[model samples]
Target: MEDRLNRIESKIALSEDLLEELNLMVFRQQQQIDRLQQQIVDLHRQLASGSPGERRDLREEIPPHY
Candidate 1:
């Protein structure tokens, strides 16, 4: 019947809208994930460069009178 066809069309439209919304949400989430990943990489680089190049050993120190 025509009524059944109309109902089916409406359902299809609604489904398409929902699918588009979900896709947009996924895109936004991926952007946020990329930004966070970049931040982590930047922080790691900062930590690596800020540390001392080498550590000194106490055993290598000579006694005060030696």
Candidate 2:
């Protein structure tokens, strides 16, 4: 029947719209994840290099004989 065909068409359109929205959301999330991963990698590299700004001293005391 024509009515059934129209209903099916409407459902298909709605499904397509939902799929498109979901795809965009996934793409945005992926971009955010990539950015975070890159930041982590850069931080790791900086830590591994032992940059002067990241150095710390934990000496307890100095001897008086020096």
Candidate 3:
């Protein structure tokens, strides 16, 4: 009767706490992913712009014997 009801209430409370913790963890991970994505975009922009000293030529990789 009352004892069974108490047990069920306790289980429901624990489940609610666990759900909140999982949601917070997922939110933090999403923030980290957003930051990493921004870094990738910045790097791509830098590579594409190729400012002076950052220039790279693929034709430089030729063997001396050729």
Q: What is the C-alpha lDDT of each candidate?
A: 0.93, 0.90, 0.91
- How does candidate 1 fare on TM-score? 0.73
Considering only N, C-alpha and C atoms within 3 Å, which residue pairs clash in candidate 1? none
lDDT of 3 by residue, 1-66 (tens): 999999999999999999999999999999999999999998888778885255558798787898
- Ranking the candidates on lDDT from highest down gives 1, 3, 2
User: Residue-wise lDDT of candidate 1 within 1-66, one digit each (tens)?
Assistant: 999999999999999999999999999999999999999998898778976346779899999999
Name the top TM-score candidate: 2
Model 1 residue runs over 4 Å out of place are 51-66
List the RMSD of every prediction in angstroms: 7.2, 5.8, 3.0
Q: Which candidate is the best by lDDT?
A: 1
- Provide the lDDT at 26 for model 3: 100
- The per-prediction tally of clashing pairs is 0, 0, 0
Worst 10 residues of 1 by lDDT: 46-55
Cα deviation in Å at residue 39, candidate 1?
Answer: 0.3
